[model samples]
Target chain A: MIEIQNLTKKYGQIVAVDNLNFTVERGEILGFLGPNGAGKSTTMNMITGYLPSTEGTVKVSGYDIAQEPNEVKKRIGYLPENPPLYTDLTVDEYLSFVSELKKVERSKREQQISDIMELLKITDVRKRLIRNLSKGYKQRVGFAQALIGNPEVLILDEPTVGLDPNQILEVRNVIKDLRKEHTIVFSTHIMQEVSAVCERIVIINKGKIVAVDTPENLSKAITKNSRFTIKIAGVKASVIGALKAIDGVKNVEVSDKVEEDVYEYIVDSDKQVDVRKPIFFAMAKLGFPILETKEEELGLEEIFRELTTKNIVVSTESDNSKQDASGEAPEEDDQAEEKEVE
Target chain B: MLSVYKKELRTYFYSPLAYVLSGIFVLVFGIYFLTQTMSKAGQGIAQIVFGGQLFFASFWLVMLIPILTMRVFAEERKNGTEVLLMTSPISVPQIVIGKFLAAFTVFLTMTALTAIFPIIISISGDLVISNTLSSYLGFVLLGASFVAFGLFTSSITESQIIAAVLGTVTLFFILLIDQLKTLVSGIFLKIINQLSLYEHYKQFVQSVISLKDIVFFVSLTGMFLVLVMIVIEKRRWSQG
Candidate 1:
């Protein structure tokens, strides 16, 4: 329901968000995964029409953000990184104010406000001044403010930053429930949040998109081989030799000895190849009994670290090479010394 | 725009600061009424309304307006709530005009309370109703212009203290520009004298509701309000 093309934001000499192009389909929950300063918030602000991009265009449901911002803004409910709140007002007062600002129909304003309060579980503290509420409560109130008009699009930045573990789970469930009605694009550095709630993930680093895919596909795409850990009732050398000799087996290494007779080995097979049937037949022929076997898949955390860290390493290596070529190599030597000290 | 106007109006009534400001506002006007009319019984009610007493009360306006308008935009920017307002479907001009009218309404309400002074004078002696009405008109126009100036200053910064300080200093200089006319000469002196903010009120206080004076205050208020809109609009372009 949203399309952004060549979105770039520059503050004088510093480019905050550079040529970001992405889209969110209707009713899709797209997770924006990035480290801090990855331009996630800047991109969101530009999409919500809060900040004008230096050179870009955002279209929300066929309306251009620059040309028809009012229509675009009417459809977006943005929860900024720092919840924008007037602390002097009560929770109910703030929500109603937001409802009015969002221009909810007069007949449905009260019902919408109460339903949002109920959804966020903030009804008990509705009468309390926002400044007096706890941080988690304040964050929930911010969420409620965004949900006031029941907008078609919800853009949340770090929706669960300071909440307790239970609250985080509650918020995730609420967002999942919201996905049935609204298209969502939320940003967070927490890998588990994306895996739990988002259907697709877009990983960004240093103002550029690094990868975009479903969580499962992202993890599977990171490595060329499918790994398997198997324990067999056989000598380690024979089991390793037999596993390596399989047609689809790429590599095998001894991992552990569970007992005097049983040994565990990690086996790597060619991509999209399943070695279980061949291993079982071969083991039967060799008189080796199989005890346990399980496939290993990469998790979101590993995929994220691999993607973000690779960019850092590549950039730093290029920087070091450039410094060496320029005869300004002492900085790299100093960095090496610092690394050694660590 | 209506939403912002109503929210700001409610904030004025809900905050204790507004009450304190209104109380001090009435007290200052009451003192001026007592000294300028009650102590001297022979002066016409028109004279009291048009006197140096009401003119000096404009000084109190220069001091009190910052309290009303300093937090209009500055507080929102500081607390980051400008995000909510700016991102709403409302345009920048709507936000500026909504806030300007809110502050001006509070100033108008405070000045309206001084109507009791004119009523008391009318009951006790011969009061020229036309002059009284005209003077009240002048006071409203003057207060509205000062509020516009304060709101303009508030829009330029995120610190309420700086907005208030700059607003007070700028209005104070405008209030004293008439005094500086004596130091200059010829056409320059006349131009500076005419530009004096308080000088415009002289015609209104004398029971003269000339279109020239009304246009002067209205245009001055409009000028500052337009500047505020420009400042807020520029912010959208420069911010990322």
Candidate 2:
């Protein structure tokens, strides 16, 4: 279990983490969500006893980080943003060193190391130098290092940042399995990873907590206006005019033709309106058959954008457009993989 | 502490640092031994073991100590391994002492290799065993102090080259203090002479084991190690 109270970190005049108060219970996986420079990593660094908080106290497993650092540190395992690896060492040597440093019992050290290596799937590269490993392997090695001592808490920063889709899924499943035994707090900008693995989500922006809730509740709470993308097999003008004439319809935007006769239109509806029934009846009367009609549910992506960028309209528009163009769900995973390859 | 000491000692052999440092050490000490032996001729093995040769070998320590210790902490910080070290269950003093002893062990091994010179002298001629033992004791104490200073330097800087330079310059000044005493007089001269690192070695070179000199070298080594601990403590606060 972990508790942070009125925690703050300042560098000169700038505050990196400002008055953050959150608690993570035992065996619960908490996803830390934020944009770049949102102090997600800073908060994690403070929680793990890696960086001392300037203003407040962090208590882990009933030990204060400032007053009893070694005891608190003994309970937490941290994988910093950049894995702290000695490239000159082979995988076995590096992990052995880590095991020793963490004071893992000598009798069980070999067993623990092998078990972690097998779990992360880095056993084949155990004898190779860490410097020669690919980015994904290096990330797993970092993960293995954090698991050496079997600490009660695991704090991972961007655990799946550079892995391919398969590797990401493997890491995700491994983390999901780990949740039964360890309290996990992992930070990431990727939205789907949070929804897939975390039990509770803490959304942070600009060194402050914006919202904290379950993923389903978060999406439902932030969505005010409902929009539907409806594809109709008819002329665009009559369909748009008819949909606009519906009472609950707020606005209509029609897209260019995909085929000769099929067209796409986005219909905006006021809150608590069942425009689907009205639009279906109106288009039915107009003889414009609806090809596809589905209500759009807000994903974590839209929720994140809405929470983080409350001031800049243009940038939020561009962010949404970029997300839409690339089909935001899988694009980040592919981009991180591509960057790793290059 | 034992685990960290073991890992550091093993790490030296895994890289070329330990071997390269020993190679340079043997080459330099070998040259000094042969030259001093040839010059002394038939004056006996005491001259070969306790005279100018041992004193001159201490000079090689200026270069050797820096090379051996420059990478101890600086390299760890650069590779980000310091995070792994600092966040572990071990305290800062344990880490520092572990690294310091490892470097000192390397220094002792190099000195042990040079012991063949005394053995050869004893076989071919009369050798004073007590004289050689005291001289070796003095050499160990001197090396301990130098290693401590170099380790302290390494802790304050992230760049190994800077650590090496700072260590060499600090040792160079300590070495120069013996000669600088000749230019002053009265109490000032006595104080400057007392500050010389080589001054404490004179009793051992004269085949006399004095308690004051032994305590001086030991306390000096302890003082530097304490300074290193303080620096590391300050780093923890400043890093926040």
Candidate 3:
């Protein structure tokens, strides 16, 4: 449905988006994953024909954007980062205006609009002014606006940015549902969002493509050593010795002390090893009761951080600290909501 | 183009700016009409003319038009709605022309309201219909040119106040060129005389419908509209 080749955008001496190449197959949900200012929005804007590329071509439905922008634009429904809303207009009024702007047929405009409003669950507030709505409702209206012409390609730039957890889930589900009919290119810094809804992920950093693969493959490719965290009630030195004595265990260290004589040991092993059962038996043989055990599978968050922050060692510590300060799951959501309110 | 025109027209009425500006325009027009007509009470009613009223009204446009068109493109850029328009299937020329027409419609409506002055004169006393109509035609043409200039200024900046200031300064300069023409001679005088908007406007005030003046206003309007489209297309490449 879409093909982008050698796409580049530069601002004087600064290159914003550098030599990107990707394609979205019909009905495929492709995730554009990157940290803040990773040229995600710039790439999306170029794809949607809102910004002209400094180099290369973006062809949507076989029409080159620079040469045939109207044809390319006709097949795309874009939700920009800011939602492109007119606060003075009502939801219905805004959607109707978008329908007209998109050149939806006069006969089908009303029915199509109502159906889209129903899909986004914004029908109830259709008559209300957009300025008076909360952030979540306003976002839904923006989504509804994008759906007005029923374009075959949907370019959503952080569609769930300011929504609460429930709203985010709802938007994720909407994207999941939309995958059946439209080719979607969704961009976000949130790791979980891409893993939840996108079939394939494109990870970019500092205006360059770092990794492009399935989420599962990306995690597997980055994690070469299997790691385990286990808590045992025994003398710390002996616990570490037993864990290290295991056949496949490469290294063992006391990660933390949970309580008196109870220490958490981080065990590293070969990739092919199933060291959990062996560690359990080894601890039992030493009469050191196993308090708890967990295999720490590297998640998309780690993969994202590893891929994005590589070679930028000076900034890695601060990025990790920032991620740690926000407790992982709802950090981006909370920060974005705070910004919306302000 | 029609879609943009409709939406822009609706936006003008949705805010209080249009109403306030139109009210001021009418108030200014009425004051001019009353003073011009009352001062010539000793003469016949046929001598009570709209020529002076329209000439003064043209100056008011140098102030009012910038305020009217300041938000046409600047607000869209500020609110991030330019993305919506630029990404749509509409061409840059279509968007510029649609916005120009919408602003022109509002100017026409404001000009139409002042027709009440002429209507009263026609009913109570003798009135020269051709003179009154020609003055109106000239005023509308001048306004169209001012609106196009204002729209071009708006397209170049994201700040509405800055757009307004740029528009007012340029329009004031265009109007003032007529006075400056007398101070120069030779080729410079010829160029200034041709560039002066009021110099072309003077013939219409005398109830003359010269095609040259009509063509001048129209070409000026077209030049500004084209400049607006160029600015928009250039920004698509140059804006960050």
Candidate 4:
């Protein structure tokens, strides 16, 4: 188990991590989510004892990292953003060195080195210097280095960044296999990869955590208006006419025209409202047959955007209301009253 | 400590670096030995031991210092292997001492191979056994200081080029401290010049078994290794 409490890292005037708090229980795979420069790598560096936090504590399996670094280091395996590999040594020789530094018994070092290479499927390249291996194989060699000493915690920073599609799946599968025993904290900017591999997501933005929730709940909660987009082979006026007349449709508008006859329209409804059946019937009655009616899913991407951007949106109405009451910008009071309900 | 020592030592032999540097040392001294001994210039046993040890001691240290110690920590940081060492359970001193021992072992092997010079001189003429023994001891002490300088250079930078240049330059400065004493007439300059590694190696080269010279060489080696340890410790504070 890894417990990070109020972890903050400040580099001069800029704060890279701002009082961030999160935890990974045994057997939990947490997807560390953030945009570029969102402190994902900094946070991982702190947890793995690569860099120290300006404030707060990181405890690995009940051992305080700062107080007992060797204890914490013994329990955690870190693969930094760049794989820290020795290019001169062969893979087998490098692994043996790491195994010894990790305090593996001399008797079990050989067997353990072989087992880790077998696990990552790098046994074929074990005799080769790491400098000669391709990017994917080098990454696997790095992964093999982490698996030495069989530490319970694994912190991988962008594990599959440069891998091919097939290699990405294979690496994902290997991480999943390790999930049964190890507490994994893997960071990535790709949301789809998080959804595929992570059981929970902690989205970070601008040095602060925006949200922490299950992927399904985040997707559902952030889809506020239940909006639907449909492309139909009909006139814009008729499509809007058909959708606005539905019982549960809150608003309808023709968004774009794709072809001479096909139109793209947006339909907004109340939360939990399904207007596909009503729109199909109304369009059929008007003699404009519905070509497509599919609900637009508010995926992890949208949820991430909403959570990260919520702070800066001042709503414009609040500004106007304050100005109208205080007699500031009094000439715009009439316009402000017009938009009071906005 | 043992593990890192083994890794560093294996790295020396696995690559061509160790053989190349060691070959240069033997080759330089081989030319010197052939001219002095085989060409009949090393007529007396005393002359053979005195000249052989002096030639081997200086050049062996100059070439081996840069090649053997060039990559100790600087290369690890550049090639991205410092993360493995820092995150491992081993402490900083263990790593410093381990790398030091590894580089010193290579120096010892180089020194051992030059044993052929003394044996070759002995085969042709009667050997001045006592003088030959002190000359070998003198070479060993000087080489130990070179190993210390190699590691100290490696610790100061992440670029091996810079490390090699810095180590060679620092050794050169210490060697030329004698010239400074000659140029200046101050008492302090004379005292500082006495701290030079070559200045202290002089007494033992003439087969004078002075304890003060032994102390000077050993203390210089110990001081540099400790300074390397302090620099490594200070780096962790920056991370914190």
Q: Evaluated against the true chain A, what TM-score does chain A of model 1 have? A: 0.86
lDDT per residue (tens digit) for residues A85-192 in model 4 = 888889988898889889999999999899888877899999999889999999988888888899999999889978889889988998999999899999988888
lDDT digits (tens) for residues B152-184 of candidate 2: 899899999999999999899888888877788
DockQ of 4: 0.37
lDDT for residue A253 in candidate 4, whole number 0-100: 71
Q: How close is candidate 4 to the true structure, as a TM-score?
A: 0.85
lDDT of 4 by residue, B121-220 (tens): 6776667778877877887888888889888888888888888888888787777776777667778776865776766776667778799889988888
- Per-prediction TM-score, chain A only? 0.86, 0.84, 0.83, 0.81
TM-scores across all candidates? 0.89, 0.90, 0.90, 0.85
lDDT by residue (tens digit), candidate 1, B16-48 = 877888899889888877777766765543444
Task: Write the residue-wise lDDT of candidate 3 on A210-264 in tens digits.
Answer: 6767787777677778888888999888878888888989998888988899988
Candidate with top lDDT is 3
The pairs that clash in candidate 4 are none
True lDDT of residue B120, candidate 3: 81
Cα RMSD to the true fold for all candidates: 6.1, 6.4, 6.1, 8.3
Report clash pairs, candidate 2: none
The collision pairs in model 1 are none
Candidate number with the higher DockQ (1 or 4): 1
Q: Say which prediction, candidate 2 or candidate 3, comes out ahead on DockQ.
A: 3
**Candidate that scores best on DockQ:** 3
